[model samples]
Target: MYHVVVALDEDADRARRQSRAVADLPQAAREVRATLLHVFTDGEGASATEVGAVRRASDVLNNAGVDVEVIERSGEPAATVLDVADRVDADCICVGGRRRSPAGKAIFGSVSQSVILQADRPVLVTGGFEE
Candidate 1:
């Protein structure tokens, strides 16, 4: 199976885009296993499956016949995502990219950028839907 760690955030659009990218993979139903990961920065005890963005992404992947699992964690987003991806031995890490200025990224730090740069495996970055 081609295992993937899909890092999701509160942005429903970004989640949808990330899910589509995975679902569109070759033989997704037969070969892809997606782990939907959500990191809670705030100390909320909410389940990952309960998050709106995660639910929407799960629906999309389910409709496309991809095997899915949901995991929730509390920590720094990028670091948590990387640690989970490593633990899962993911073949790829999927993340949604937000448009940010270089300076903005420099100051705020980009999760997608961090994952891309740090992951030992391939990273797939899906852009937010253009309106």
Candidate 2:
């Protein structure tokens, strides 16, 4: 049994995609536990908007019967997710990815890539339904 940390974003659609992806993972049912991680995603202050997103995600996962937990911290997005992974001793991390054209990747860089480089554990990448 290993810990799996999922990178949850502020978007409701993205979070739902992530939840379904986690449910489909081959290891999801076999794993001892799953941690549905979402960072504050703000620099410092806790915005009421962020609070709502977190609650929305928490409720979604909980209703799905996920062995899930929410992690809220103010920091860099990728850094916060990686920090949570370390804290939970996650064996693997999963994150939602948007469609990135080659040029787009060159310009904006990839959030999933950042987490992969920053985290000690293996990272899984998934795209939303439209992506």
Candidate 3:
């Protein structure tokens, strides 16, 4: 089975886009498995599976007939995502990216950018809808 790690954040739209990207994969139901990961920063103690964004993504994947798992971690978002992906031996890492100027990205330190640059395996970045 092809495995994908989908890194999700608080944005519902971003989660939808990321989940849809995975659900749209070829023969997704028969061949793909998706792990939904959410990293809680600043020592926030919350259930990842209960998070709205995660739930929405899960619903989408479930509707598409893809096998799904939810994982929660606490730490820097990018680092945590990479660590979990490695632990799970994911075939691909998926993340949602918002449109940002070079200066904006440089100043804001985008998690998606960091994941893309640091990941050893394939990374699928889904762009958010035009704002």
Candidate 4:
């Protein structure tokens, strides 16, 4: 049974792509457990809006026939994700990295890199609404 954690960024494209990946992940997966994680970026990253999104995602997943969980927390995005990974002992963390220029990445660093480096498990990263 693998535990998959997806970081739900507010971008519609990212969310769509993330949804595709999760929905299409091999149905053969034994004991598949999926979780939608959102961080509210106000120093703690826990916002009512984010929490609602996660809850909505969870409902969608449930309707799709997959057991799902929604988790919302307050903290740095990367830090919050890593912390959740620990609590859930996740097998993989999925996130989307906006395609940005070198300058942008330099200024913002990489969310994917942060999760990969900070997490104890593997990280799956993709651009928003990959088509």
Candidate 5:
């Protein structure tokens, strides 16, 4: 089975989309195991809302019969994601890139962009949430 890390931020809809993207990966020959990851930068534990988001994504993947593990970390989002990927030996990283203009991204930075640039493994980026 292949292991994948789903980067879930505060956006619940985006998190769901990322989870669905992982679950939709071709499972014809081998099963896909998913690690639902959320990072709390303050080194605090996950908040209730964050936990709820994880649960929502977990439910989607679990209901699809995909092996799922929920992981919460304390650190910078992109760096922690890469760290977790290494620890989990992830085959790929899945994340949602919220809509942002070139100027905005340049000024504010982007976790998705950082992961795509630095990740040693494949990174799957989904567009922002849909209605």
Candidate 6:
């Protein structure tokens, strides 16, 4: 079976998009095992909203008859995601992307960009989302 690690953020829309992307993957029913991962950079545990979003994502995969696991990690977003991917031996990493101006990106780094550039495994990015 193919293992997929989906990086879930606090943004509900983005998190849902990431889950939808995983659901849309080929062989999702028969060959996909998904882990919904939320990384808390502050070392704090998941907030109520975060846990709800994770549970919602988990439900999506579970309803599709896919084995799902929800994991929470504490560390830098990109680094922690990579660490989890390595530990899980993920076949691909799924993340949501946001459009950012050059100036904005210069000021704030992007976790999706970092994962795409630095990941040893394949990374699938979902973007162009409304809301």
Question: For residues 2-66, could you state the per-residue lDDT of candidate 3 as single tens digits?
Answer: 99999999898899999999999999999999999999999888899879999999999999999
The local distance difference test score of each candidate is 0.93, 0.70, 0.94, 0.71, 0.84, 0.85
TM-score of 1: 0.95
The sequence of per-residue lDDT tens digits that candidate 6 reaches over residues 7-69 is: 988777777777888888888989999988988876676553357668778877888888888
Candidate 4: count of backbone clashes, pairs at least 3 residues apart or interchain: 3
Arrange candidates, best lDDT first: 3, 1, 6, 5, 4, 2
Candidate 6 residue 115 Cα shift, in angstroms, is 0.4
In Å, residue 42's CA in model 6 sits off its true spot by 1.6
On lDDT, the stronger of 4 and 6 is 6
Instruction: Pick the lDDT winner.
Output: 3
Q: What TM-score does each of the candidates earn? A: 0.95, 0.75, 0.96, 0.80, 0.89, 0.91
Clashes of each: 0, 0, 0, 3, 0, 0
Name the candidate, 3 or 5, with the larger lDDT value. 3
Q: What are the runs in model 3 whose C-alpha is more than 4 Å off?
A: 129-131
- Candidate 6's C-alpha runs over 4 A off are 47-50
Q: For model 5, give the 10-residue run with minimal summed lDDT.
A: 43-52
lDDT of 5 at 11: 76
Tens-digit lDDT track of model 1 for 24-113: 999999999999999998798889888999999999999999999999999999999999999999999999988877788789888888
Q: What residue pairs clash in candidate 4, if any at all?
A: 40-45, 44-74, 44-75
Model 2 Cα lDDT, one tens digit per residue, 61-131: 56655677666566677887888888888888988878877887799787788997777778878775433
- The Cα RMSD in angstroms, rounded to one decimal, for candidate 2 relative to the true structure is 3.1
Encode model 5's per-residue lDDT on 1-113: one tens digit a residue.
88999988777788788888887889912599988898888767656335767888888888788998887888799999999999989999998978888788889899999
Best by TM-score: 3
How far residue 109's Cα lies from its native spot in candidate 5, in Å, is: 0.5
